[model samples]
Target: MKAWRLGWARGVVELRQSFSNGGDLVSHFLWPVLMLVALFFLRDREFAGTGILLGTLALPSILGMNAAMGMVSMSQQLTADREDGTLLRAKATPYGVQAYLVGKVVSVAGGLIADLVILFVPAMFLVDGLVFTPLSLLSLLGVLLLGLVATLPIGAILGSAFPSARAQGLVQLPVLAMIAISGIFYPLTALPGWVQVVAQFSPIYWLGLGTRSALLPDATVVVEAGESWRSVETVLVLGAWAVVGLLIAPVLLRRMARRESGSSVAVRREKALQRVG
Candidate 1:
């Protein structure tokens, strides 16, 4: 059918099945909640939602973590689709491939946003008096939109690159490491000069910076000249990365498509049987 109609149809199907993974959703959220609890109990004694900002750093940081986690999880789903021959089969139909692709990205993005709600709403009460100002809310939304745009395609590329299902599980460690080095949980100033330099090259760096900017109103206190902590030029960099990521993801998909062997399932099954015998 038509591309638009196909997009809609595929979106529905993808969301239906992808969202059906309720256990994965629970898994995605469980650890973060515990972390939040620790922050509330441990960090709270040290830092109150003092000053004008209430839930600024904590909420945004939580959002940033969700974005990172969501990207890796989304990638694994794509890799699974490939390994199971699901994506290859869908690609054979007119507009089916495009629809499925759109659906995959959209569902993942939606789920990530939903996760933000889950974390923030509960934390409003659970994490002590975390308040939101108009400007702070706008800033949070800005960072979130930019992050969604920037992260979705990167996840797609990684999913395509590491099509092995096992690879998906281990990939988050490196991603979390990038996040740590990117100064999401701590100040970049505390990290070594070389480590900071390495973190500067990461997408999460731009994301963290942008999110922090949204939360920290007093620009001088939050960030200043020559420091990579402020939104500064990271907004432009994030925008550039978003465009590049979306464009490159399709190209990567096309290249992977060329590698399909076009073998029947029967042949693969027979080969498996022969090997077993």
Candidate 2:
């Protein structure tokens, strides 16, 4: 209980720092601004036969992609902390690893939510055809919440498995590929049938589908798989991933922490300095 409280406090402090730090603030806003600009250009363009503005469809999909990218941020931050000896220091303290993990989850999730708001508010005016009824709002919230739970723990496992910050780059290529196949900027129906089959297995696809379901009008359903939102399938797939990730993450994180030591941190730091030099 005490550790949980301590973790929560630590997360709050870090979240505050993320907003206060000039570079971090710039980073937090940069992608959303780029996305908005892209949305601007796409706003007038219409999807073939669908009679929907590309931007209107894209806006919600981008939101989902951004939410899933939280996983990458989590992995990168973990690697950075490991290289800087933060993980080692935490290991030396009593129940510090538990506190540190809790703090990371809180800060990462909080930051993702802030970024979503930054994207969503300006997005409402720039794009039209969005339906934001009370039910839609609730659906959006549910999808976002589920998306985070599905991705974050898996991210923790990735972070723990990678031995160095540079190795984290390997995680990004697959994520980008997943985003492309997941229909963030475009509809999946336009893609090859096999690709759609592969994408359905990924969380990114479900997140995008869920977000699109929440924001786009019911008429737009004709373009989706089964010509419906498949809300049940979305929940089932994401829930399964969440369950798997939650079960595996703790074991992986504990194993990773058990191996952390001052020597390993020093080795990583030396490698990082060499890269910089």
Q: Which residue pairs in candidate 1 have backbone atoms (N, alpha carbon, C) closer than 3 angstroms, thus clashing?
A: none
Question: Which regions of candidate 1 are displaced past 4 Å?
Answer: 16-22, 45-56, 126-131, 217-229, 261-277
lDDT of model 2 at position 270: 90
1-277 in candidate 2: lDDT tens per residue? 9789989998999999999989999988999999999999999998895688899999999999999998899999998898899988998898799999999999999999999999999999999999989999999999999999999998998898888888988999999999999988889998999999999999999999999999999898887877989999999999999999999999998898899888888888898899999
Per-residue lDDT of 1-277 in model 1, one digit per residue for the tens?
4766776666667556655798766765787677676557544442223332323444556667677566786688887777667777877887767777777777787767767787777666654433368977887788788888888888888887874666776778888789778766555656788997898787877776666666554532333226435465777887888899989998997776666445633444455567669
Ten-residue segment with the worst summed lDDT in candidate 1? 46-55
- Candidate 2: list runs displaced more than 4 Å: none
lDDT of each: 0.68, 0.93
Q: RMSD of each candidate?
A: 4.1, 0.9
Best by TM-score: 2
